[model samples]
Target: METFNSSKDFLRGINKKVFIAVLSVAILMTTFSAMAIRKDVVLVCDGNEINITTFGGTVESLLNKQGIEIGEEDKVIPELHERVTDGDRIVIHRAFEIQLVDGNEETTIVTSRKTVEEALNSLYIELGQMDKVQPDLQSTLEPGDTIRITRILKETITENQEIPYQTTIKYNDDLDYGKTTRIQEGRSGVKEILLEVTYEDGLEVSREVIEEKIIQEATNEIVEKGTSRYLVTTRGDSRRYKDVIVMEASAYTAGYESTGKTPGDPYYGITRSGTKVRPGVVAVDPRVIPLGTKLYIESMDRTPSYGIASAEDTGGAIRGNKIDLFFESREDALRFGRRKVKVYILD
Candidate 1:
């Protein structure tokens, strides 16, 4: 009876140990099943879509599990503490550094906005109609992009300008050739001008003329010029002459010494005007005094006058205000070497 009792006790102890082992295994399987409950979630990050499976939890827990860091300016669609469910979509916009150059100030900004217009609106930066912005307002914002804003201003101003007068000349046949008479005085005018000026960042960029008004009309000056041809001789004699010239005078004879030809040569003792050389003949520059023009010669020094002469010849040495008087004898020609005289041109 004692042996049978010991055998029953040993079998009961083995059965108890087996039951404990099976219960522990059951508990472990249940815990693992609960931990494996995962949900299908879609994450959109910076415009890129991603499919992910995560254990059911809050949005903050999901992001922490994925090792994603959130910034102050970053945007998240769902609240961080919101519980996540199956097939839930989560959107995230990562902020990026951007350079801002507004007028003369430069600064760095971090923004999660999609475009330049949205970014400026969030910052409360206003723009004018005439203002200009670089990278355009509609352009997409990129990482490390530089945005420039140019402030423009316009203003209109008035200015006064002076107008110059004109001078006119009229010819009068009654007055002498060397005389002039003033008929009217000149007066300047006044004009008003309107200008539109443009400035960029407090600096002048350009200016344009908008309107012009003439305040006063200018008066033209008028003067009269003489056209008559007449003069009196220095000898107190009233002589009617077309022109007068002070000329350097010299005398020449119709000999081999002056004419370079003997008396019997083909052109000897003849003048350029188809006349014979005589005492009253004179050589002159044909450009100054036309050949065959009548002239009277008077000496400037206290010497006898050369009397009346005719411009009937031309000489190679006679240029400008120069004259050569013809003489009959070589002795008389040498005696009147050179002198200044006044020659009158008769009409």
Candidate 2:
């Protein structure tokens, strides 16, 4: 009876140990199954779609598990602390950095807006009718892109301008050549000018003349030009002559050294005009001064004048505006040498 009772107790103890082991295994399997619960989610980031199966409970946990980072300017479709469920779609709009140059200010803007127009509107930056925007407003925003805004302004202004006067010249036969007389003084006029000025960012860019009104008419200036020729002599006598010429004067005697002739020749002392050569007789080019023409020769420098002379002789060396005066002696002729003189042809 004692052996049978001990055998029954031993079997009951074995069954109890088996039941406890099975119960512990079942509890561990249930905990593991609960931990292994997963959700099928679709994540859309910056227009890119990703399908993932995650065991995270919230959007934040899911992103943390996927090693994704969020910035202050970044946008998310749902709140980070919101619970996630199966077949849920999560959207993340990544903000991009853009360089903005508005007028004189340069700054950086991070925006999730797709177009430049939307980005500016989001910031409440207004644009004028004449303002210009580079890359256009409808252009898609890109990372690290530069957007420039040029502020255009136009203004009309009035200014006073000077109008130049005209000049009129008249010929006067009484006045001498190279002489001018002013008849009237010129006066500048005044005119008002209207200009449209264009400015870009407070700097002048262009200007256009819109209107002009004359405030005062300009007075024309009158001038008289001289045409007559006259000269005053040393004796304080004013004379009117047909023409005057500057000639190179040279003295010569009736000798072989001057005319290549001696006293023995028939035309030795006689001139081409059939007259004897004297102190007042001079040789000249007939094409310039006709033979027998009377002239008053005055010295141009400090030398004494040649006085009254007659063009009654001709020589091969005397041409153009050149004159050869007759001298009594070879020594006197050599002393005279050559000089420039003004010869006036008398009527």
Candidate 3:
């Protein structure tokens, strides 16, 4: 019976050692499980980085354990209520004030977005086709930055305008010299014009003429200029003249019977203009036809025609339109008698 008791005590001692070993293994396994639940994560906030090993849980609880405070407008990547795993990243951006100007209205906004486009989207601001933005939508943003938006508008309008009439002049010989007569009166016309106008923020930016149409035809003014007279020459050629006259013409010779001066005299038969008397050289009254004036003479009785002549000398009987012609011989002078003739003053 004593040997039996001794064997039982030995068994009890071995069992106690085994129980302590088992408890140690269990404690080690519990510690390893707790270690397995921890994770190495990166925390990015305030333009800085913080690396740490932490227990796995929701992002909100982890941030709270690190003593990080989140505001209502603060942005957190992966969201605060989302679960975190090993090698997870936590990014936090602090909210900042921004000035937003849309057309004529301005307002203040709080946002944590990284770009201008994201911030505008968050604020529910929409853009139109013609709308313009400052600091472009894809640009990076900073605190207190100003964003301006402009609204563009276009309009087309049609207007009626007046077209002025023009004046034209024509020549007429019925009226006297230096006289002007109106043949037609002038009148204005009408036209339609289209214009395009652009405005920005209720202020005009530019205007352009787009189209034009004629609505009424204009009437031209006509004026008559009356001054000159024309004459027909015996040679069938038309010539311009200022006056005409009917004259008594006669013929004489450079002889003692024609002039009181003798033929031997130096001044006898010579004209006042120093020209020798001939068929085309004529004598005239200086008061009637001025000296050095050109003339065309024709016999009214159709006997002969004097194509062109010059008034270079004067005679006592040559007054008004009367003229005297010189012949080379006395017989020729006697043959030609005094008769009415047509005299034209040529230009």
Candidate 4:
């Protein structure tokens, strides 16, 4: 009876040991199967779509399991420590450094917006119609990219301007050379100018004249000039003359033979025109050279020139193209023989 009891006890102990071993193995398999259970999730990164099955508890754990590394500059949609569920959607965007110059201010930013326009809109920046942008608004932004914006303001203004009159000179033959006569006065003209002024960032940049209107017309000044004849004397002096004549000139004295009277006669040395005989007085034919006409006598030969004289007398021998020059002394008259002389009528 004791042997039978001991064999039963040993077999019972082996059975319990085998049962315990099998039960421990079942528990380990159940725990491992629960830990290996996976959930389906959707991952979107940089516009690329991806579906994955991960055996992770949190978003960071799931991404790490998939070997997806996140940088400091990168952006993620959901919180990294948040627990993930079945059919969860996760999005990630890569960031880059970009410089934006808005008007007179400059700012540096790191963003994941695809284009410059989207970036500016995301920042709530508005653009005017006249404003300009550098690198284009629709251009893709990259690392170390830069953008510039210029504010343009235009305004139109009207102004009154004065147009100066042009001076014109005209020659007039009736007026003397070195003399002027005003026929008209100079007047300024009026004009209205429309201008367009452009400013950049509150500072003037450009100006343009858009339109011009003439209000008043300009008047020109006029003058008359003289074109009289002039004669240059022997002493290099110039004088105005009306006429000229070449005549035969002879010399006479206030004597009884020359004047047909003696000194005792009242009109002994008197001329036909009742003028006293003098060195500058001459007798001429009235038809050729009228009496009382002023004259300038220039010697045609080498003889001394009779500078200035007047035709105030007529003689018996003095006819057409003939003149008689008077002298006080008979000796001087006898010495002055007949000669041809040039006479000019003074103005």
**Predicted model with the maximum TM-score:** 2
Please give, for residues 1-347, the per-residue lDDT of candidate 1 as tens digits. 99999999999999999999999999999888766677889998766799989878899899889888788899777878898888899998889999999999999999988899989998899999999999999999999999899999999999999999999999987778768999999999999999999999889999999999999989998999987776454456665566789999999999999989996898999999879899899999999999998888988898888867899999999998999999999999999999999898977
**Stronger candidate by lDDT (2 vs 4):** 2
**Looking at candidate 3, what is the lDDT of residue 154?**
89
lDDT of 4 by residue, 1-347 (tens): 99999999999999999999999999999988876676788999767899998766899988888788988767677768898887889988788889999889999988877788988887889999999998899899987998899999999999999988776777765566557777778898999999999999889999899999999977766665555557777777787876788988899888986877888999888888887788899988999988998888989987888878888888888889998998888888888888999888887
Score residue 266 of candidate 4 by CA lDDT. Answer: 92
For candidate 2, the C-alpha RMSD (Å) to the true structure equals 8.3
TM-score sort, best first: 2, 1, 3, 4
Provide the overall lDDT of each model, using Cα atoms, as 2-decimal numbers. Answer: 0.90, 0.90, 0.86, 0.85
TM-score per candidate: 0.60, 0.63, 0.59, 0.48
- Structure candidate 1, residue pairs in collision: none
Ranked by TM-score, the better of candidates 3 and 4 is 3
Inter-residue clash pairs, candidate 3:
none
